[model samples]
Target chain A: MDMRRLVGRNFARIRREQGLTQEQVEERSGLSQQYLSGLERGQRNPTVVTLFEVAQALGVTPVDLIQPDNVKMPRKS
Target chain B: MDMRRLVGRNFARIRREQGLTQEQVEERSGLSQQYLSGLERGQRNPTVVTLFEVAQALGVTPVDLIQPDNVKMPRKS
Candidate 1:
């Protein structure tokens, strides 16, 4: 395993769909807006716990964040 | 928002109950073993994107990660 981009993009998209701002996410998840912003860009490497916090705020599960859409396994370079 | 531990512990407990190891999670999620290890322990602060990857791997949603359990608002210091 090397990289995971789907998660961040999906997360940001979903958040937008839900009409939630980074500030609200921060207020709900106790995470800073700056960090949340970074997460959306896929620039930050989050821990499982933090993932849980963000997930809880969004009303989903950790599994949802990591599930592959097409189920295509990419080869490591 | 100051602290959010429920998410991390809940995630870890669920993963453990599901019989998953950090290596297995890494293998499934395109994440590193060390990073996965840190995530399980809630030591890592994951970005939203990483959160998505982890949730996807677990077969859940991001909402599941950030949604507060009791719906109780903690007083911010």
Candidate 2:
């Protein structure tokens, strides 16, 4: 599997589902919008800490960011 | 949560459960045993691709390596 693409797709989907913009996520994650954009494009390979920070900012677990499309993660309300 | 430690613990536990050593995992994952040791000690922060490679080498999904302690993953045969 293309893990980077999978992560990017999941991240984009979750962010959109939560009605958040990349700029908003950038502010929350303390990551640059450019970086977020690159990540969404699967152009950035983020470390575990970066992944955790992004997941935290998105109000989700790191697992949620990398889950395969076939597995449905229960959303937090 | 300390994502590094959590990942390390999970990795170590899963590796042990599978009866494999760091050297063996290093051989399979193409990651050095030194690196794997550091990772297992929560001293290394790996990229998502590295995580995927390690998980694949272990014959498990990336989710399995990062699963929270409270979430019991069904073992694959």
**Full-model lDDT, candidate 2:** 0.91
Best by TM-score: 2
- Fnat, model 1, is 0.30
Candidate 2 lDDT over residue span A8-44, tens digit each: 9988999999999999999999999999998999888
Model 1: how far residue A69 lies from native, Å:
3.6
Tens-place lDDT digits, model 1, residues B1-75: 322355566567666766887778788899998877766565766655666677777776655655545667788
Per-candidate total of colliding backbone pairs: 44, 0
lDDT of every model, 2 decimals? 0.68, 0.91
Candidate 1, residues A1-77: lDDT per residue as tens digits? 32245557656877887899989989999989998887788776675566567778887665555554566779899
For candidate 2, the TM-score is 0.90
Q: TM per model? A: 0.48, 0.90
Local lDDT at A65 for model 2: 90
Q: What ranges in model 1 sit over 4 Å off?
A: A1-4, A71-77, B1-77
